[model samples]
Target: MDLPDPQFSEFVTAFLKDRGLPVEDLQFHSLPSDGSKRLFWRLSPQSDTSFVAMENTPTDDFSKRENVAYLMIGRHLFQKDLPVPEIHHFDLANGWFILDDFGDASLQESALPKERRISLYESAIEILFRIQTEGVEGFNTEWCCQTERYDQYVMQRYEANYFRDAFLHKYLGLKKDWPELENPFNHLAATASRADNQFFLHRDFQSRNIMVSAGKIGILDWQGGRLGPLAYDLASLLIDPYTGLSSSERDEIYQHYLRFLNKYDPRQVEPFRKYFPYLAVQRNLQILGAFSFLSKMRGKTFFEDYISPALKSLRHLLEDLKDPQLSPLKEAVHS
Candidate 1:
């Protein structure tokens, strides 16, 4: 992809100069884009300091709001002692900011031994607990990029319909009458919507968004967080396709999360477990939809590589869940 404009480079240099950082030998390198519209760069100088510059095009009001939220939420999380990068400077008018360079030690990029994987996940789960409890105290709903709550409308319209339109119809070209799957889709959404929404949720809590450095886990890309079901993030973490965590490993992590929950609120463990599978189905389907949309429509083929793993996760979760109401949806996915 093309690098950011030369003006952006000059802007970064000026931003650094204002911060009293040496700018004589500053170098800028573009970072690979994820599925978002944001552009990232790594800025390094003669000193032993580096920062990541994120630039967002304020194309519309939604984009502007999202950029603002990134700064607002990053500061909030940092103040709450969460493991988010510290924001050094931000320009809301131009939609760019400087952040601490956490380096590229994301959990998704790490090759973990079995025992090490378990320990790291334990740490990650502990962070999740704190983010849910402590991070919710002063969080503002207006800072949320999307809906304030992951309610039934979001589950049904944004996730389920996204799967139908993007994955089933657009990517696979499946023209069959899929009316039979509607009941199961609605049932799954309804079930997930009833989950506890009293905690902060990291909507995309997968391995790729988790940075691991010096045996510490730092969370990233949390501008989309909102008040939602506690089980949603847990399901996202455990059933993540990128990590390729085995079923046994997932079971162990699930149990570990329950134990963690029990230490604080014992009453929530049973219901959380009961609702996890349903959320897994919903989450996995949403991943497939995103992969399809990104690959086919947006011309980002890298996302397509994860589709098979996502499908494997979806089928496995469906098989493990013997709910009769989900049979049609299961068959639809299996086909």
Candidate 2:
């Protein structure tokens, strides 16, 4: 029960008091930090009753937007009966909130057998479909933290440029311009931007963000979600470097998602599959970039461990796509 500094403790005490809860008996334990600047603490009041406190330390306007987006999107999803944490209390002015504790059983930490993993992934896919469809009915772009849409600009700037700067330059220290890559990135951005089925895209739909507790899957860290190609999130999940899913497993999960889409919206099946690989390439590159940035710039060295897996995933995607434009990227990655 190592408490935070006195000021942080006082803040939490006052916050709990406002909600008619006594903090004198509560025990607070700091949780491990993620890539984001937010700090998390799990506060336990009883054997079974606990809450997770989140404190957002916004260094600039961008992080501030993320703070607000988390609260707004979280409330919206909870109201829609989505499997997100229930917001207990939030104060936007000070950037702190308490939420229902989903426990520490993230999909990344799950050590389930093959059968259980398949079943859990099936449920996750179903929930993803609902978020893409039902979750978009009343979704407003104004609630998005940064980019309103996962358009070409986002692909070029955030995904491609991020890979170029963070992974290629900063991490790998690759100086070669690799002029051949420009055309591939351009083609990918163009094709991905024109994807037909635009829906709510969970920008970081990886294993770590999916929490599994009591046989139910709960989504977390959705502050960066926005309107984007349906394949973006699907790609993010299946090609997640952390999960290390085999080709067969990835195929099974992808087919499952297709079956669900066909049952609900058959019209989207073809286009979704057509754009999935391209989006996967984009997602993998973004993951590599993010892992590298988090490791080098943010000093979270654990992310460095995932860089090789991310590169491998990217190489596989490029090879499977077999697009001539991607040849240069393939060569560079292989090199």
Candidate 3:
């Protein structure tokens, strides 16, 4: 994509100069357009030190409570020594943020040897466990809606329907009769709204939201958080569209997560396991619809890469479900 206007670039250059950094040409590296809410640029001023300049778009305005809750959670993760980016400075009023420049260190472009992949994922799993256990404090779970509370009447339900109707039918030619889907849809909604599974959800916790630097992974794009099932974020990561980890690798991670959860709260372990597959199925379907909507209506097909893994997860979820109410939907998807 073309770089943003020279005015913004010049403004950033001047801002850095006033900060007494250095004097030279300013080079800006804008990331891909998949994440539109935030704009990232690498500000290099010919000096040894460099930093990342970020601007949160207007659409990313979060409630003060949500913002504070996220920051508190981020701080808690940092305190636990998790490999997340450090916030340098933030101007919420102007939507400008500066963070430590991790430098060409992303899993997408990593030059690490093959042997290091397992270690990286292991570390990621460990930290995820820590968050699910200890990261429950910063946010109020009682207020934040859980996946179980996400019924057909919930406002979020429209996100899925809109994705399907406006995008899948309108653009992809994959149309579903609302009447045929009503029963299964209602069942899915009721199942989710039972509020059975609840935990700290990272909302967008996935590989793309993760940064790999110095053989460590750091999480970003966590402005939206809530109290929900751990599986939501776990599925988002392992079944991430940008990166589809192998089945064996995903299984290994799932086992690791189970172990961690069991150790954290033995009582909730069974419930988590019982509901994890259901959450995965629900989340995968929502994502599939969202991807189509984003690709068609929103004019961003970047989510296409995530479709196959998401489908695979749907299949796996189906294998775990013995509930008759969900079987028809599973058949519809599989068919």
Clashes of each: 0, 0, 3
Model 1, residue 79: C-alpha shift (Å): 0.8
Model 2 has an lDDT value of 0.85
1 or 2, which is superior by TM-score? Answer: 1
Ranking by TM-score: 1, 2, 3
Candidate 1 lDDT over residue span 187-262, tens digit each: 9999988789988988899888888989999999988888988889998998887888987888888888888889
Whichever of 1 and 3 has more lDDT, that candidate is: 1
lDDT (CA) per prediction: 0.86, 0.85, 0.62
User: Model 3: how far is 156 from its true place, Å?
Assistant: 5.4
What is candidate 3's CA lDDT for residue 211? 73
Off by over 4 Å in 1: none
Candidate 3 or 2, higher TM-score: 2
User: What TM-score quantifies how close candidate 1 is to the native fold?
Assistant: 0.96
TM-scores, each model vs. reference: 0.96, 0.95, 0.81
Q: What is the C-alpha lDDT profile of model 3 across 1-335, one tens digit per residue?
A: 54756655665766677788775656777865364445788777756777777765434335433444444555665666666667666555555566667666555445235566667777777777667556665545434322323344542365446534743466457665555666766766666555443556676676666677677777775555556566667776676655556778778878877787777778766776666665666666676776766666676767666666666667676776767776766665666
Off by over 4 Å in 3: 1-19, 59-81, 108-115, 140-163, 166-168, 193-198
